[model samples]
Target chain A: MTFATRFRKSIEYQVVEELSRSVRWDANRIVVNTDAERLAGVCEALAKAGGIFDSAVLSSPASTRVPQVCYAFRMPDLGLGVSVFARGKNITCLSTRLDAAAWDERKIKDLAGVQLDGLEDARPLLAHPESGWGDFAEAVSKNRQTVLKPSEAYASREYAMEGTGADGEFEIPVGPVHAGIIEPGHFRFFVGGEDIHRMETRMFYLHRGLERQAVGRHVQRILPLIEQVSGDESVANAVAFAQAVEDLEGIRVPERAESLRLVLLELERIYSHLADLGGMATDVGFYASSSQFLLLREEMMRQNAALSGDRFLRGVVSIGGVDRNATQENLDATADALASFSKAFDELESMTLSSSTFLDRVFTTGKVSAFVADELALVGPVARASGKSCDLRRHFPYGAYKKRAVCESMAASGDVLARFNVKANEVKESARLIRSEINQMPSGPTHTGEKRTGHGFGWGWCEAPRGSCSIFVRTDKGRISRLSIRTASFRNWRGLERAVNGNIIPDFPLINKSFNLSYAGTDL
Target chain B: MHELSALLRAPRTDEISEEATDPAIRKVAALLRRRSGGVFSRSIHVRMVDAGSSNDVEVEEGLMNAPQVDCERFGIHFVASPRHADVLLVSGPVTLNMRRALEKTYAAMAEPRAVVAAGDGACTGGLFKHSYAVYKSGRVDEVVPVSVHVPGNPPSPYDLVAGILQAGLALDKKEAAKSGKS
Candidate 1:
């Protein structure tokens, strides 16, 4: 028996008596249904049984069914991820036990109108003063044309910065409208004598009701909309969304298509990392290094445009297949571009590393302890920098990753410098993987294997430049029933609060840039 | 010679012409020539607001400062506050959450200020206007009247520069229209 099967069999044989009567595998997803009364015991048993908490999935009530809320778990050792679901209007709060589930459960409260019985924080997740309660059903419903807007401000408008009870603490507020060419997000720092006691981040200023807009849309038509969830992560989000739809319909992607997807994903990682690396240098006043990095980044983008029609690599990905032909000629040109990039990048990396000024600023700045990272369940480079061995490409191989091994770059020191080192090493690994995949990729017709009529649910993920991005897609007929996008930024954004504690106010920008969490992705 | 050097030495195919080529750009170029008589503004100060874009325009705006397409060399500079700006660059479809913020930024700007809607989202709300979290249409013009529109899913760096230059051209009309109204 496979590990997941063995684990299930052991539970059946009384290894875990509470969950034995409740669990069964729906294909690869282990579905556990238990009464609300027995839910806590089952969850505690499952966690002891090596289940890592992912996110909680929420769905509004259908005419016949009650509102359902599900908590997803990943069995790291067994290569299996499952969701424990319960149907109710008021579900028990999983965050009370799992710290990682707080943000998601809070969002579920706002979106589906499902209250968590024991949840501590009662703030709105996506509802704004102007867009109060979102009229969420019409926003995501199939029959709906224009999304519903709230008439008048229906709820509390301001974000209350809950005090840490520190005496003489004053607040320093920064942008939803910032200084540079960046997105809007408000950060309120509760400080006493420049020592930040606590920082509260207010996002959703960029929340455009992505879930509501996507719910009733056909799976095939949502690719462009998916790309917009986070611009820098366009290709990564597209691949995840496409793979989920493919999984829902049981379509098999061609090897050539898989290889092409890998190349594009790696290229996206390179450019995204370059921007971050350059921004780090710029933040530290090393303008020359920043310029070099941006020049290099510009070259990569030019090459992206040459390969794909759009610079952001939009319009190239479609459900079940890619839109553009990733012919041998296109792949060869990309190889040549990457070959040049590697040499230029090597020199830049050495120059940046050797700079003592840069190192002094980044080292020991914004340290996230391994313990805290674990508690928050951080993913991506942020988690890996703190020595969390959880790259999705390595852990749960899908698409091209299943065909070949991914050698991940990790760092033990959870600081800005460590995050920088992790990204620098990853860029090289991605480039190496791209070259190897291209050399061995088989030649074949790029499109095949899709059935559009039937429906089911499946999850897809890939390691984005910053971290692992996962998409959960449940389909009803041909349209999406529910879509939950969990970006690496979403998990790590929470970790930012803990990371920045005790660091000076000025170092905040450097550390923030290092994490580079997406406001759009997180808010969505 | 190193391949990196050759790549760096490459003539960029995406630069805006010193002499105008596109008809809209020609109009701007002509006005700008008269404004300084061939001498560009010491700095065409710009302040940007992300109204509701997918951030493609911001990516392009950030790229405009890169060595090849450096907007600073041409005397166009991004400023810290709207109070010092001669032009406003807005991206995204204006979300309901950001409508007041965008308007406040525009109101803070000095007279002769021109607004350039930088992406498809900012121009016509792109794909997100109808979404509930966004303003009714999400167009920058709906919130703050736009002087120029650079429409792409995101317009390229050069296209953004041309649009900014067009906003530079529109500055003269703000004066003319002001006098005309009086």
Candidate 2:
């Protein structure tokens, strides 16, 4: 039998097995009620069959009062993802067996009120004690019933230290507000002089109920809102979400739209990654290098504005295809910009690598060990930095990525410098991909005007700048029934906690810049 | 860059000789003199909690150091936080998710406080008033009281400096007002 035939059969067998295991699997989704002990065995079985464990979301169904724990695992060979749902009896904690499952379980415990029976490290993930998890859950659940939807509750109740510390271990509380014009995230540092003993980050200060607001709204409307989730990564998230919806509906986007989508996605990646590289350089006082990056970033933003009308590419991508089709002139302008960006980036890259000060501060700082990275299941550059072989584009091909291979970037150092190097190289690669894709333009409509088939579940994802941004949609007869978007930040935020362990307090910003995760994306 | 050029081209008090001794200019100069201190001691940390606004150009241009009010001299830092802030500069109308963060930020500051409502959105809801995400229509003052209203799509950096200094003055007044009441 052919590989495709074998792959299809494997998926069918997996589905049947899940059905025989539990009656809850009747809905077509793989629902197995295995005990906590069997969780590792299930993961291993799926892994052996070329399945990649994506993310485990801690969510509550709008109707049911009980909390739901869903683990999303992807079978690359079959191009299928099965969401394994295990309800009742939170088996201690799953993190001990599956490292990536640890923090997600903690987050579930904090938000949906599930007790991870044997989970290690049971501290709150996004909320504080003063701001109880039940209160936030109630707020999120109530959003469904309100006229003016009450956004997800954003609060963190302070939790006192459990044990007594040595005298003079003063706490240095930084932000909800900070020194930079960034998002709101509170970092509590237990410091003895400048050395940091423990660093705890409390965010969600600006949790706009993005999912709640998206509830019941047409798929088209949510694209613009998703773009606005983070000012910088608007296009990446939108494309990822749209791809997910399209996958579920089984709608084939026009060849032209798919090609253009690839072009825009790459452009977005280049600009966003450039900003990060520039910001990292600036943070370490490399002004000459930083200034050059700023200039490049400005050029890209102007090109984006001229081509799409909005600098950030907001309101661009839609469900069927893109909202605005790019003319030949716009396409030419973009190609020209990519060429110039390539030449200029070469100079900046050389300067950044050659600079001793830049290398010293960024290298060997903010390290997340290989074992820790596996357990936490970090995504994007963070996951790759720690020598973890993972990339959504390579693991699960979607859009133009499936047709045209992505030259995946990875680093073993797992330091700030390693992240910088990986991103810098990726930026060049993105430019190269954009140039090549545009050169071989496809001829067709940018979108399919047909109505969506709403009786099935759709899943889609894109390799976002921060990490893999995955979206799941369940449509009930042409309307969105349930939607869940697990951004890269949500999965990688825990990696930041682990990275900051041995570093000094002052080095926090540099370490953070390395990961460069979005607070708004995670909070939502 | 075009927006930056547009801001640079605008006439400042230095360009207008007749307004050298004007009260507004005097107020501006007086404010500028005391603006040496910023949100952070090591850096001039300017934390902008943009409520919600459509004028991103004006908002972006307002961040640059214009012909006047060289914030770099004062070591003023432009930050994204409100917790470690010495000043709270608000832009755009207060949106629902952002309302609590704004109010909590104002309350979190130590005693002396100053708030600058930059842009029409922060001063008035402007175009986003009809949107459901907006917390309070009209102004940020509706959600949390304001000390200075720096109105523009986004005010120029000079105007931003003027607003920041005004916030410092308000902080002084707040301390004095507390003393007088005591």
DockQ of each: 0.49, 0.15
Per-residue lDDT of B1-182 in model 2, one digit per residue for the tens? 32234355554324323246544345556655564453222333456765544324222433343224336554455654555666777765555545666777778665565677887767876544444445646378887778888875435455666676677666666666777899
Q: In the order shown, what is each candidate's alpha-carbon RMSD?
A: 3.4, 7.4
How accurately is candidate 2 docked according to DockQ?
Answer: 0.15
Residues A1-524 of candidate 2: C-alpha lDDT, one tens digit per residue: 96446754676446535533442333223444554445545655555566566776643344456655566776655555666655654544556766766656765675556667677777665444443233545555565222232343443445554312757888888766556656557788877788777777776554445555555666766675676556566778888888877777777888888888888778778877876787798789877676567667766766887888776677778888877898888888889988877987986798788888888898899898887776666778888888876777787667777788788888898989889988987898899888888888887788898766666566678888888887767666655655667888888877887798768887898888788777767766
Question: Which candidate ranks first by lDDT, i.e. highest?
Answer: 1
Model 2 score (lDDT)? 0.67
DockQ score of the complex predicted as candidate 1: 0.49
Candidate 2 chain B weakest ten by summed lDDT = B54-63
Query: Relative to the unseen true structure, what is the C-alpha lDDT of residue B90 in candidate 1, on a scale of 0 to 100?
Result: 95
Residue ranges of candidate 2 with Cα displaced over 4 Å: A1-51, A58-61, A66-68, A76-80, A87-93, A109-111, A114-116, A119-134, A144-157, A161-170, B1-45, B50-87, B91-101, B104-139, B147-182
TM-score of 1: 0.92
Task: Judging by DockQ against the true structure, name the best candidate.
Answer: 1
TM-score of each: 0.92, 0.77
